[model samples]
Target chain A: MGRTSDARERILTAARTLMLSRGYSALGVAEICAAAGVPKGSFYYFFASKEELALAVVEEHWAGQRAEWTRALAGDVPPLRRLRRLYESTEAELRAGRESCGTVTGCLLGNLALELSTRTESVRERLREIFDEQVALVAETVAEARARGEVTVADTGAAARALVAQLEGRVLFAKLYDDPGRLDALWADSLALLGAEESQGAV
Target chain B: MGRTSDARERILTAARTLMLSRGYSALGVAEICAAAGVPKGSFYYFFASKEELALAVVEEHWAGQRAEWTRALAGDVPPLRRLRRLYESTEAELRAGRESCGTVTGCLLGNLALELSTRTESVRERLREIFDEQVALVAETVAEARARGEVTVADTGAAARALVAQLEGRVLFAKLYDDPGRLDALWADSLALLGAEESQGAV
Candidate 1:
């Protein structure tokens, strides 16, 4: 069962890579199978259709982000410091032009929110919930900041959405310019807006 | 001659609308012609190929954006206010559920940047110029804010890129979440960063 499940996981990962490079519409199931080294016949045993496979792929991506953020941000570091560290690591890779998932992932769910949301409420609803959860997590940090008086966040909900918006924007810039400097600038401006004492920390 | 040329312009508009709604890859020439009510022959007469048409559509979109920004973001109002007004107006329209162009138009240019930059230098170079132009324009505005002492910009170039990055992200947000509130939240954070007094325009 473990070996079989590994095949399923590998197939989903291949789909993710292809979608990141070629986009959702251009990615094909056969391509995933080839990349994953899984037989075409085996894919249906694990997933129903290309869309279902794509959904699984999206779920996997979202889970990875949440887990990563949870670990980095919820660790012993201060809330503000954690946010800075996360963005700082992103800045280093972008500046170095290393292989990274800067911003353009566009949210697998957010991507679906655009392409699939109106047509399929179930998927759309899933996306909405994911966004809500991520925002809530960020909001918890903001709430902490508010308590500490590190910054004046009159609206925690609005602040969380704003951070998401900023991060989302950075992704587009990173992808659009193919030069990560675009995102580095966003990192600085975000830190500045949050009234952070350090600008050099992000880069 | 003007009437015939006007029809050509009409064709370009239709292509842009389709690109924004459906994205560049998914939109077909026939579909654009149908939307424009322009004959297929007319489209080919005005443009060499679908890729060529994509370039033109993106170019026209940028032109309109420059004009819109100049008109909407200019005035006696403070720099921060003017820009936020521009953003807020866009937000109001999106919240009302209008298929506005700036959000997605899938940025035929950005779509090209993401998909074809490595494979097609001709496409990449042209799009690069557009992105640079966008960055420069925002830098100029940051200089304006700096002149007024309304904001302190240590790196005008970075600030410019971040500003545009924010807009690009807001566009994706509009597509992903289909919500304008997200954009407004971004606006609020940006204005705050620009040193806008919270008392005057607090969201």
Candidate 2:
């Protein structure tokens, strides 16, 4: 069972790499299998179809993001600080990825949402839930900030959506231009979008 | 020469439809030719390669957007009003498209930027230029709004970027969630981001 689980993990890891660099539609099951170093039979044993494997990949990716969100954001720090840290860490990761990949990879969920959202209903629904979960996490932090008198969030829901959208949009620009500066400029702007302090470490 | 141009236009039109419904990476040259009702030789005669044809499609699409932007946003009206009209018209188009396509197709450039930005440098550069051009147009409007006392834009460039990102982000969500309401909510949020009045037609 342990060996089986390892094979599954390898398949997923390879799919994430290939899908992130190329796209969901460009890569096939055979390529994913080759990249994973797993036999095609094992690939089928793990997942029903390419779409199912992609769904599993999305789930695994979201679980990792959920863990990071809980760690970096749901801390005892100030709400805005946690949010800023989240964006900062995301930018750092994008920078690191650029060094190896020669370009920013942007967000996997966002890239898939753009490419596969309309093409597959199951994937679209899964992505929708992931986005909702992520937005709710941000909204919760925002509501906390408002409760602590740190920010004036007229509508926490809307503010969270705006911030998340800003993050995604900035990532898209950063990758497209091959410049992370495009993302750095958005940190203060995102706080301002929520009526939070535009300066650093402002509680 | 006229017939050559007609074949070129038809090929581009077909590529746009297929790419928007499917994606840039999924569609093949033969399918594009079949959809356009043009022969393979005509495709090569009109364009050197599939990538070249995709570039032409992007240029032609941007021209249509430029025409719409100039008509809806470049008028002598109040800057904020022009912006509102632009969003309104865009929403109208999205709604119309949804009625026909069963989902929001999203902005063509934005969709391509997400899917092809990392895979191809030429497409990424073309997209970067398109984004820059669009942002400049929005920045000019923000500056005008500031000059006319319609909105207080502290950093017109940043505000324009935020607005553009917000639009793209909202489109991503709208497509993923299969809900245009997600995009409709951004209208007031975008105005608020610029510190503009949320009232109707606040000239």
Candidate 3:
């Protein structure tokens, strides 16, 4: 049982890494198994199909990210400051990824969302749920900021969506240019999007 | 000569359609040729490789989009108004795509950028140039707006890049949700990014 569980974890890890750089449709189960250092039979024992494996990867990646997001946004600091920390963390992750992989791998969810949304129904539904959760997480922060008179935006949901969209867009550029520095504008951009005063010192 | 040129056009069209729905890595030359109603041998006659074909598609798509962007950005309108027109046109394009295809295909450049950026260096370079051109086009208008005191953004280039990034981000959502209405926030988001007044008549 221990060995079986270990193989499953390895498959998920390999799929996430492969999907980060190459995307979904381009990946193959055999290649994923090879990258995971597991035999082909173990792949089927773990995932019924490639799409199922993709779902497992997505879930695992989001589980880690959600933890980070919760920690970043739940601090006692100002709401806007917490948001800044989120962006800072994102940039730092991209930088770390570039150093380790020699390329910006981008947000796994965004990359897969664009690549598989139209082709795969199950993945599309799963991504929608994940992104909705993300927007809600950010919306909670925006609502806190609004309550404290830190932001002028009226619709917290819309504001949060815009911030997430901006993050994804900037991350897209970061990956495209292989330069995580593209995200430097994210904090300022978020402040502007939320109608927060620039004097907040979050930057 | 006319017959040969017609075949090339068909291949490009087929590839564009397929790439929009399925993306690049999943596509094959034989399938593209089959969709084009041309012989597989003819594919090699016009393009050296799939990468070259992708380059041609990018160039052709950019030529059309550049023309549309120029028309939308130029003329007797205010700079902010012109920017609104650009967003409106983008939404309209996405809507039209969804109407015809029953799914939002998204900005071809953005879709390709996220999927191919890390894996394909040539596509990455071309996408960078294209996005830079897009940012430059928006920056020119931003500089104009700054001169007119319509926007408060200090760095026109950064502001423009933020607007473009916001756009690609929104478009990604539109595609993921298969809802062109996802772009309704773009004009508002752009105004925020540009630090333009909410009272701007553009919205």
DockQ of every predicted complex: 0.39, 0.74, 0.87
Top-TM-score candidate index: 3
Ranking by DockQ: 3, 2, 1
Runs in model 2 with CA error above 4 Å? A199-203, B199-203
The clash count for each model shown is 3, 0, 0
Instruction: Give Cα-based local distance difference scores for all models.
Output: 0.66, 0.84, 0.92
lDDT tens per residue, model 3, B96-145: 98888789999999999999998888989999998999999999999998
Cα lDDT for residue B3, candidate 3: 99
Q: Ranking by lDDT, best first?
A: 3, 2, 1
User: Highest DockQ, which number?
Assistant: 3
Candidate 1 regions exceeding 4 Å error are A1-3, A89-123, A199-203, B1-11, B37-45, B75-77, B92-124, B199-203
lDDT, candidate 2, B3-114, per-residue tens: 8888888999999988887889889999999999999999988889878987998999999888888788876777788887777777777788789888888878888998
Whole-model lDDT for model 3 versus the true structure? Answer: 0.92
Please identify model 3 stretches exceeding 4 Å from their true place. Answer: A201-203
Task: Please give the distance, in angstroms, between residue A86's alpha carbon in candidate 1 and its true position after superposition.
Answer: 1.8
lDDT by residue for model 3 (A64-145), tens = 9999999999858988889999998999999999998899999999998888888999999999999999999999999989
